[model samples]
Target: MKNNTYYRLTLLAVILSLSVTAATFGQGRQNRLTNSPREGYWVIESQPRQKSVALFYNDDNQLIYKEVLSKKRLNIKQAKTQESLKAVLEQALRQWAVSQKTGGNPIQNDQQWLAAELN
Candidate 1:
């Protein structure tokens, strides 16, 4: 019962957080990237003092990839712009490309994803 309650609360918190985030685009404070769309679909979740989490979802809404962007590379100031958002996504892929444990042909995966997104 206790575990179930905890799970419910956790789920509720996530739903609330997503709804609130979906409803707002306030700058420099949890800004959701806009004006840029791509294959599958990707979202940048940036928070102050927190390394932004990037989630890429397929057309069916299933998550495809998840990565954390570099703290030094996260440009919150320009994240709202289309070009900036693309750059941020590229940055995440570039970071992923170098990972040994990134699983499955990183270069091919990175190139394909980048081509799909940028082209």
Candidate 2:
């Protein structure tokens, strides 16, 4: 009887350990877009009338981090390893700056203006 009880207890312990391990592993495998990465891009919502842009990069799974460039030239670099996204963001900013300098709005409502500037 004692040997049977011992065997049952061992089996229970093994099952419990496996359950715990499986739970932990499942949690670790969450969607990358939901869990912020140590490096990459993420998109966040902005306030109304706030001209903001977010550049994101993922490890083909989750967004690691982001670079948020605001309208007031607020350069906030949140990710460490998204150089390509950063370059594209900077290019967009440069284009906007040039449009402002040239007294032309890059994002105007007029279709002609947009087509000319984009082209």
lDDT of 2: 0.47
lDDT of 1 by residue, 23-119 (tens): 6746534344443444345676877775666565545675555655545234445534446446545555454446536665443222333333333
Tell me the tens digit of each residue's lDDT in model 2 across 1-119.
99999999999999999999999888777744344434433353455566544434343543323344344222245343244334443444445458768988453221222122222
How does each model score on lDDT? 0.54, 0.47
Instruction: Give the CA lDDT, 0 to 100, for residue 59 in model 2.
Output: 37
Q: Estimate each model's TM-score.
A: 0.33, 0.33
- Number of colliding residue pairs in model 1: 0
Lowest summed lDDT across 10 adjacent residues in model 1 is found at: 107-116
Q: What lDDT is reached at residue 72 by model 1?
A: 28
Residue 21's lDDT within candidate 2 is: 99
What would you estimate as the lDDT of candidate 1?
A: 0.54
